[model samples]
Each structure stands twice: as structure tokens, then as C-alpha cells.
Target: MTSSSRALLFLLACICWVPVTAGAGERPARIVIDPGHGGVKEGAKGPGALREKEVALQIAHRLRSRLEAAGGEVYLTRERDALVSLTERVEMTNDHGADLFISIHANSMPTPRMRARTEGVETYFLSASASGEAALAVADRENSEAPMSRAARGDSTLALILDDLVRTEAHADSSRLAYAIHPRLVARTRAADRGVQQAPFFVLSGVECPAVLVEVGYISHPEEGLKLGRADYQEKLAEAISEGVLAFLKDTRRRDAARPAQVAGSQTP
Candidate 1:
């Protein structure tokens, strides 16, 4: 996809969703966009010296722009290049009372010597424990950016607090967001569909809203790296994400409408 082609796709997607009538009472949706890695924390690297932080931030900005144009209130965890603690990022959104949290990232593998052909987007929700190799791979790369200390590795105090407070309301919502976005991206970009999974991402575990971490593509794969580095692909990535967020809002509204109203019995005599 070229830049012009990607822009056309985004324009078309926007036309499909932009409300035409009765837009009167609709509340503007809010979203928190977290661009993974920053400052000294150069996340995963690609074949051509592309940094995960750089691409993540670019995509995050693109996503923010799209959401804002669609009448959404989007907040960014970090606007400039600076190291932000994972705990702080989640807390920021919690404090802001945002509707959803999305962390953007690119994937990398350890076997740099032997390139395995893996390319796709994977969406994740918080889990107490990650299941198998997929979970392990995610942990390894995410951990690489911020190595865990002994204190950090210790008990489950943080997890317990977050599980009780943060992730409850939005786990299913985040999963649905993931489901909505990943396929659109795959279809539009012709990328592989890694599908959505649950993983205990430390960054997402502490958030209050429905939170998800999106691995946009495999930086480790040479071809994928080239594709992701292109502005065209990034725009497509942004547009697909925007569509998913819209879907989430639409579904939430529908669900709220379908729920029975609570009636008070003889409150006043």
C-alpha cells in the first residue's frame, strides 16, 4: 500500500462511521493511547535500525489524530521521548477516567541469527499468568525493555490490587476491541491474523479501563520490518485501530441500552 492508497482507505472507513443524523446527544468517547517504549528504553529493534519506541510513538500519534477527527477525546501517555514507568502509565489513564486504554508495540524475537517468519497483530488482555510459548515470548520481549528487579519479581500485591480494582470492568471490552481491530487490520493490510489472547502484561495489569496491548507486527521479520517502516502501512494500522475503537463504543452503547433499568420500590411513601 502506498501513502495515497492508505489515506483513501482511511477516508472510506471514516465515511462509513461518521454519524449523519441525530448526533445531538451523543457523548464524545474518551481513549488513552499508550505508545510503548521511550527515551533510553529502546524497545525491540528491527533489521534496518528501526526502534520499537519510534514506530510505536508514530503509530500512536496517528491513532490519536484519527480518533480525534472522529470526535473522540484521545489522551496520550507520553507525547515526547521520555522514559515513563509502566505503573505510572496505567495510573495516568486511571486518574483521567478514560473509557479505554491501548498500548501499541512491535514484536521481536531472540533468535536474531535464525529468522523465523512470523508476522501479524496480536491483541491481549490482562491475565494472572500467561499460558505457553506465546505468553513466554511476549514476556521476554516486553521484559527486555524494562528488566525486572528482585523486588519487582516478588509477591502479588500489585496484581491483587489491580485485579480487584482495574481490569474487572474492561477485560471483556478490551477483548472485544481486540477482536474488532485485529481482523480489520489483517484484511486491509493482508497481514497474518495472530488473533487475540490473554496475557499478564505488567503494563496492562494495573489499568482501570478495559486495557489492551497491540503488537502491530513482527519487527524481527525483515519483510515485516520493511512494511511497518513505511508510512502507508502505518496509516493503515492507524485507520484499522480507529475503526476498532468505534466498534467498541457502538457495542457498549447497545449493551447499555439493552440492560434492564433498576427500579426502586416505594422509595417515598
Candidate 2:
């Protein structure tokens, strides 16, 4: 069967069943999953009739399932085939006080005739500007022409004044989270292991927590696209991501616990 048909079948199967729930008194880690493109805006297209929106939604659902099964509190930016603005998506995560923000996407290349050999996992953290080609490509896809005021864009002097506040706070954790998960993803995919990097992706910029935009694999790569469309591959991909997230959370908690205690002892007489 064609990939789209297969994806539809998979989605139906998920919908038909009730998701397994977690045990009592378990405080699941809160996660916000953003399915890349939706509604009229089909992000990218590939061979075997793979649309970016379709794959993103499918992956987001699967990812949510994986995270929830591991006792994570998961929320999706878009549950169905509908358009959600970037600004709104960020606000949702921020408002919900989500622990992490993960925007799921599939990649497409400019050159259609480019060979199908390119395959890998690329994860991105927030940055002020793109330093390279991979960064540029991600930025270009995400920086859609949604209308925004000059102030919000940091085009005004006052906005620039608070830039440091904006910069120093959230993105540090985001970078650390990305670093933690990326290597695990590379190891699991066993594809081209493009290491973690920073870029000015709109999706990652506004959130006030650890955030990442995951380009799981190049859908334009014919061979990889076929693999991505399979249920087995999807399960493996979700499993790897889950493992990475769990490891990161555990390590972070331990590191936090190791810091020396501040005792207000021996006050001046």
C-alpha cells in the first residue's frame, strides 16, 4: 500500500483504541508536542505521496503515546488537521507551564533530483541567528509569513532593551535538553548522526522551557521515506526518543540534587 494509505490506517487504529493510562499518584512529566504543519498549509511533500503535515501529526500522536506510557503528561498543539499559529503554539506551552516543548517535523530538500542517500536525525536548540546551511533551512521553513508587529520582532529600541531578559532565561535549559536527547536519537537511528546545534527557529524561540525542533529524517530521501512510513520504524523512533527523554530527566534530577545546600548559619552578632 502507498504510505498515505498506510498512515491513515495506522491513525484509525490508534483512534479506535483507548490509550493505556498511568498508575495512581504518579506525577507525569508535562510535555507539549507541536505537529509541524496543518490546515491549508501543507509544509512539504515527498515521493510516495508523503505530506509533511501527515507525517508530523502521525509522529506527534505516536510520540505522545510513548511519552504518556512512560508516565509523561503530554499535550499536542494540534490534535487534528487544523492550522495553529506559531505565536499561539508558543503561548500554549508557556501558559500550560510545560516542562518541555518538542516540535515534530519531516524534512524536504530543494533539489528534487538530489539522491535519496541523505538520511539522519537532526535536533535543534534556539539561537539568535543561523550559523550554517542546516540552520538556515530549518529557519526558512519555520519562519512563515505570519503577520507580527515590529515590537514583537524586536525591531524597536524598547524591545531590544529587554532582549537580555529574553535571551538568558529559557534557552539555556533548551540547549541542555537538546544535547541530552540528540546523541541517543543518533545512536538509535544509526543513520547519519548530525550532532546537536543551535538555530533561530521561531518554534523554539518563544517557549520558556527546554525546547527542540526534531527533523527526524529527510522525507525527500526515497529510501528513508519508505522506512519512515512503516509502523515498525515509527515504533523504534518513538522508543528511542522516549529513552532519551527519560535519561535526560533522570540525569537532570540527579545533577540538581548534587548541588551543595545553602545553610544560613552563623549570623553576625
* TM-score for all models, in order of appearance: 0.83, 0.79
Kindly report the root-mean-square deviation of model 1 from the true structure over all alpha carbons.
Answer: 5.7
Candidate 2 per-residue C-alpha lDDT over 1-91 given as tens digits, one digit per residue, 9 for 90 to 100? 9999999998865532222222255355688999998998788776767777888888889988988866678999999989998888989
Q: For this target, which candidate reaches the highest TM-score against the unseen true structure?
A: 1
Clashes of 2: 0
TM-score of 1: 0.83
lDDT of 2: 0.74
Note each model's CA RMSD in angstroms: 5.7, 9.1
Error of 1 at 195 (Å): 1.7
Among residues 3 or more apart in sequence or in different chains, the pairs in candidate 2 whose N, CA or C atoms overlap within 3 Å are: none
Candidate 1 Cα errors over 4 Å, as ranges: 1-26, 113-116, 143-167, 264-269
